[model samples]
Target: MKTYCFLFLIALSITQVNAETSIAILDFELNDLTLKPRTAAEINRTASIKPLLEKELKNAGYRIISIDLAMQQKANSGFGYLFDHNDVAAELGRTAGADYVLIGRLHKPSFLFAYIMGHLIRAKDGQLIGNYISETKGGDEKLTLKGVESIADKIDKDLDNRYTPPPPKHTTLH
Candidate 1:
């Protein structure tokens, strides 16, 4: 009975330690567009990149807060907020109850290519955890999704590097 109880406690502790990190991803700001007469479809396609990024982060064992919720919080806060502003990002993280915040911009150098740059920020103190930049070539939809995925992969690797636990020490019998 005691052994079983000990095993249960160990399992509970392990589950707590392995809890998924919560993150909130903001919309990617658009910049330097070369597309002539941006259509509604192109704008919508560009906006959809946030969800792809969230899905990738979720697959990487992160809990994602909804972008809508984050935006609403920003609107309620009554400030001309910027994602690069640490205080604003941190406040959004707190409002959304996220452990970290991901914010960045998308640049379209031409009609056929898109570039994305992202920054991962710690919520508690608003310190920059890491940054990633990636580019993809194609139409708006394809390029935006591909660029976001590449950035997500970079962020996933960064999280893995930061959060992976070290191996337990071994002791040999003397």
Candidate 2:
């Protein structure tokens, strides 16, 4: 009886370990912002979008993760997050045993093109998961948020189907 119980416990533990799937959405790599007039005045809440992406993922039921401080430090010192941190994000995610590591690069139009172009990559094998080269375009950071929303919405929907965590509940005090 004890042997049977031990085997069942081991199986349960294995199942639990396999159930955890983590994903990290790095900062959106934005380029071409420099093209704007020197006095264009930066877009507000632009930095907040990254967290919004993470929130959207969490709301969709994905487990978010943290990268190493050293790698983060190096990545923070650049215009492009991956220019110096691509390998680091992947390596850190892998080292931390993440199932998916999401990285995005923004290729804003040069005031001539009509749409924003973005690159989203998967860290599993360092392959491009998807690209955002839409036909529609808008100028400035607000437009960029819309682009991000579109991309994040697609990913969140896919994740929603794959992993359906308990639906979030809202309650208001009387």
- TM-scores, all models, native as reference: 0.73, 0.57
lDDT accuracy of residue 101 in candidate 1: 86
lDDT of 1 at 103: 78
Over 71-156, each residue of candidate 2 has an lDDT whose tens digit, in order, gives: 65565656665644455556656766665666655454455433334444456665555554543254455555555556666665
Question: What TM-score does candidate 2 get on C-alpha atoms?
Answer: 0.57
Compared with the true structure, all predictions reach lDDT values of 0.72, 0.55
Candidate 1 per-residue C-alpha lDDT over 1-174 given as tens digits, one digit per residue, 9 for 90 to 100: 999999999999999779888888877666656747356655676578788888777766789976565474544443224545766786677777898888776666887766787788888888888878888776556556667667876787767533222234578999
Q: Report the Cα RMSD per candidate.
A: 10.7, 7.0
Clashing pairs in 2: none
